[model samples]
Target: LLCQILHCLLILLQLVEIVLFIVDSGCSKHMTGNLKLLINFVEKFMGTVKFRNDQIAPILRYGDLVQGAVMIKRVYYVEGLNHNLFSIGQFCDADLEVAFRKSTCFIRDLKGNDLLTGSHGTDLYSITLQDTNCPNLICLMAKATSSQAWLWHRRLSHLNFDTINLLSKNDIVTLHAYFATEGIHHQTSIARTPKQNSVVERH
Candidate 1:
């Protein structure tokens, strides 16, 4: 009964080439991805697999527990196989239940809510899971800002407000002082050229 249900789940699962997994109840371990590529694999064990003609094939045990989105633990590694093998015994060990009908498989959570569903594939059942891409903490933060006073100082073509303030405080560049410094004896009504006053006239 367990094997039938698990087989249905595997047949219905949508998966890509990178994560093709076989649902094998007879297999002891939930075989994971390529052993040589996975960094977390440790504790290698020598396992022997028997085939139809009593042929035995040596297997390597690379056990790992996959949690979060799809929860499975103690998965092995098979070198030559194109797909990983999921063990129904492991699912039973985890106390999870699978239901199948109408060529579809449904995995339920502890509360009896449907966790995942998969449609039947053409040849067999294959499960495909969704992957999420989220931004890290540093990328979500806003950039730092500069002071308004410093911004205005630069916008005025590097005019030094400190020097201007000092001159005004001491009355060094008052109206009379400015006129005398510029060598203008009296105020003259001089008209500025159109091009020179164009920017001021726009406002």
Candidate 2:
């Protein structure tokens, strides 16, 4: 019974960390407590705003948000806010449309495809979101690949053709000799141009 009680407590704590953000059409930007995205900083608040009971809130620039397929750019970090906020204007800026009806709300992309849905909270519709910066997950900008040469192209840290060919010829790696032969010839031909400086070619 004690173990089960402890497990429930852990689950509650995790659920609290994954906060529910209210969809606020009046808000100018997305605001959160501390859950930041991985984007660039914009600017800080010029002054503090007083909430209920004269509680002062200082707004700061937060990072971006990129999930499996969605992206929220330039969020705000509100240290004093306990609840998260999503701005309708920001969503519209990103070409997303929001539909609110009765007690439920839906966020859709430019094509009207559903991206997220939220239920009505105490005063507004809210959706739960996890930050990409969370330690449990890592975000990377990459594309799909199936070719062995293209696969090696990334694994070898984008090394030049001649160096990659040398490694393959000397059996330093398991790469096939002909894998980059054509590409190397094309690269060599391009390198002859004066604009292809040594500094640019090294990479």
Candidate 3:
């Protein structure tokens, strides 16, 4: 009975290791302690970071997290970082718009196109991003449709394109690429500009 209980505890620990990332408006870049989550990782001397708990961690290198067709590029490595983090500032820098409701987080391209959706936990917009190469999925987030995006939009408070520019980062490009691979066209053509063709829209 003791051995069985130990085994059960080990399994539960493994299950809880599922990456829990907080979408942080305060953080400047995506950060994670698990180097295994990164691909094409490059070793370099970056710097150090002071976590919210007043504990400090070292930033060793940077890499990309390739998921399906999307690559979250330039994720910084902070060994034993207190918590995995998604940077709203970084997302905003990439021309992505982020909005929050009571329990759902919405990410969109500037064209009002949905890119990613995350659920809100007690105090964090916890977005789980799975690593494609790993056999065990770390962060398992929901994949959404356009209607889902509109639904979340209706739930948001006073924020909108007219009021806020939203989160960003270069990774937004890879996300857009992922959408393209999935047959979701986000680009529209300019009027009277026949040379610029528009991609067909799919439901």
TM-score of 3: 0.55
- What TM-scores do the predictions have? 0.45, 0.51, 0.55
Give the CA lDDT, 0 to 100, for residue 170 in model 3.
Answer: 22
Best by TM-score: 3
Please, what are the lDDT tens digits per residue for candidate 3 over residues 168-189? Answer: 1422124355455777555546
RMSD of 2: 18.2
RMSD values for the candidates in order, in angstroms, are 25.7, 18.2, 17.6
Cα lDDT, model 2, residue 57: 80
The CA lDDT of each predicted structure is 0.51, 0.63, 0.67
Q: Per-residue CA lDDT of candidate 1, range 1-203, in tens?
A: 32232222111112223345555557676665466324356666668665556666666666554323654556666555556666667666777776666677666767787755555677445555432222222211112234443444344355355754564666543544654665645433646523345432211
Segments in model 2 whose C-alpha atoms lie over 4 Å from true places: 1-17, 35-39, 42-47, 136-203
lDDT of 2 at 80: 73
Runs in model 3 deviating more than 4 A are 1-17, 136-203
lDDT of 1: 0.51
How many residue pairs collide in each prediction?
9, 2, 9
Poorest 10 consecutive residues by lDDT, candidate 1: 7-16
